[model samples]
Target: MISRIVRWAAQLVILAGIAAFIGALSVAPAFTYRPADMAFIRINFTHGAPRAECWRPTQAELTKLPPSQRRPNDCPRERPAIVLRFELDGVVLLDESLPPSGLSRDSPSPIYRGFSVAPGPHRLHLAMRDNPRTKEYDYTSDFDVMLSPQQNLVIGFDPRSGGFRIR
Candidate 1:
């Protein structure tokens, strides 16, 4: 009787350990930082021009696109574009511009502002498409940003002030 009781207790311990291990493994991915999630910073363009408008893709709209079209590099060519370039620790992680319609653009927007950056102190730079007759305006700003785990950074362009803010 004593031996049987001991065996049962050992089995229960082993089963509990296995269950705990599986639980940890399942949650580990959520806790760990994914490279893709941190690859590009978000630059939100909310202020639209007099006739220009800005909108984000809904889940249904995103699903409507084919997998090939959903890629970051597969943006369609269009006008009135917005591109976001992200730098982390002074290193550029991603740099590509897209139109307000999420299409590709040959030149970046005129009012270039804001960038998403990794969690740390970083130097942010903005470049705008300019005509040869116009003066070039590239702005650089330094910020100490700290992003918590699973945090999505948002840099906004406020038309009223013609400036950017991190939210």
Candidate 2:
């Protein structure tokens, strides 16, 4: 009978100790997102454009390739590198060049970038160049954005619309 009482007492003590440990975690140290004034900016897109215009294949050139593999127009396998620039309130935040993807270098180039800034109204300028031979930008946009605390801003490219979309 004494042993049985002792075992029950030990179990109750252990349960109480566990409950106390859990209760301590609720108040002693606090954790938060840590900051309330920082906002985020993200750029992500995958784009594809020819470095130069395609041309009709000459009769002699077409004859060189196998009959099944010959194409009506001859296009280069290598695409131009993608150049992107981002500016905020006249301060340049990012400028980068990305090479073409795929083994044959004919695929779209993918880009993903991020930045942190204070939450407020700011001017944003964005430009991109997909043609290596051209000195002009293929796409450009300038606008103002009002960011909120902890807001996530995303800029994506849509060739169908011919520019970047902010979300």
Candidate 3:
């Protein structure tokens, strides 16, 4: 009888250990965490523009199309590449030219990048040019920020707002 009790206790303890192991595996890590002395900035954006040269369909071409298919302008399927620039305190940190959409280059090109920096006050500058032919950027943003240790700064763009957003 005593041996049976010992056997039951041993089984209970083993079951408890298995349950604890599974529970540990199921638990998630802390929502926010960072290693010693580190901070980062993340930028995500998507934008595109049609080719600069667009024209109305020729009368013969329009006639071939169904009445519902006719449109004022018929733009080429290809789009221009996007130029992205990021600066930190007047120093250029990232300068990249991203190709437009996909095989046809008719979709929006997306941009996602991350940069690591020391935790302190700094100036940030960002610019984007969708038109490869133009020297000037279509959108620009500049700001001064104070960063804390283990902090993450996010930047994005909104076409409707016509500017970059920082958070």
Each prediction's whole-model lDDT (CA): 0.52, 0.88, 0.85
Order by lDDT, highest first: 2, 3, 1
Weakest ten-residue segment in model 1 by summed lDDT: 128-137
Question: By the lDDT metric, which is better: model 1 or model 3?
Answer: 3
> lDDT per residue, candidate 3, 3-28, as tens digits?
99999999999999999988887885
Worst 10 residues of 3 by lDDT: 27-36
Which segments of model 1 are wrong by more than 4 Å?
1-40, 46-84, 100-119, 128-135, 138-140
Best candidate per lDDT, number?
Answer: 2
By TM-score, is 1 or 2 better?
2
lDDT tens per residue, model 1, 25-140: 98776754455444335665532213223456666777899976554333334444434455556577556544443234333344334443345444555443222233443333
Cα-lDDT of candidate 3? 0.85
Candidate 2 has a TM-score of 0.74
Tell me, by TM-score, which candidate is best. 2
Name the lDDT value of residue 49 in candidate 1.
19
Candidates' RMSD to native: 13.7, 3.8, 4.4
TM-score of every model versus the real structure: 0.39, 0.74, 0.74
Residue 10: error of model 2 in Å? 2.1
